[model samples]
Target: MYVIHLRYTGALAEIDDALDAHRLYLEQQFDAGAFIIAGPKIPCDGGIILAATMDRDRLDAIIAKDPFSQQRLVHYDIIEFNATRLAPGLNLPQSS
Candidate 1:
């Protein structure tokens, strides 16, 4: 598993226009099981974190399609890390 850290660095004016498309893209990725989790940073800091259990190439392609990336509303610094999953009552699937 890996985490993609995205930092938005642009005018806030573009947010309303880009948010919907960005969300749609993420939804598609989630449904495809490529994205395990994703959400925006609170406090309106223009940051987002995405947990992906797929290859960097595929993830890169996915991000490339986001409205934020396409419209220069945000930029990303991807970090590939080792993830460990532990749970008790949660029935989450094992990480690939």
Candidate 2:
């Protein structure tokens, strides 16, 4: 699994300007089953995304296509971790 942290590098106006395109990209990822959960940060400085299991390289490539990334409006930090524990009712793919 992975957690993606995005920090805006540009002004809020620029961020707002790209929001629609950004949302479209997010929707596509969700439809492709790559993203689990995503939303803006508490302070609205950026956003967070929880992703399904996948290679780091593949994930990086996917993020590279995001509108924010393309415009260089945000910085990305990717963290990978084993799902040693899960909440009830949450079904995550397990390694064989």
Candidate 3:
């Protein structure tokens, strides 16, 4: 799985201006099964996205398509890790 941290690069005004498009991008990714969960950061300066395991190249391509990237509104840091433990109700792809 992956943890994507998004930090605002542009001003609040610019971020707000791109919110709609950014949301649409998120919706698309969710629909495509690329994202598991996503939401804004508590301080409202950034956001987080939990994505399903996938090829690194593919994930990078997906991230590149985010509206925030296109608009230069945010910076992203992606972390990939092996999920050694899962909660009772959690379901995710397993590593061989």
Cα RMSD for candidates in order: 2.1, 1.7, 1.9
**Ranking by TM-score, best first?**
2, 3, 1
lDDT of 1 by residue, 12-89 (tens): 778777888888988887887777777877867566555656667777787888888989878788777765555767
**lDDT by residue (tens digit), candidate 2, 1-96:** 999999999999999999999999999998888898999999999999999888888898899989999999999988998888889998986421
TM-score between model 1 and native: 0.82
Best by lDDT: 2
TM-score of model 2 vs. true structure: 0.94
lDDT computed for candidate 3 = 0.90
Candidates in order, TM-scores: namely: 0.82, 0.94, 0.93
lDDT score, candidate 3, position 7: 95
For model 2 the local lDDT of residue 36 reads: 87
In candidate 1, list every pair of residues with a backbone clash.
none
- What is the C-alpha lDDT profile of model 3 across 1-96, one tens digit per residue? 899999999999999898999999999998888998999999998999999889999999999998899888889999998788889998885421
Pick the winner on lDDT between candidates 2 and 3.
2
Model 2: ten consecutive residues of lowest lDDT: 87-96
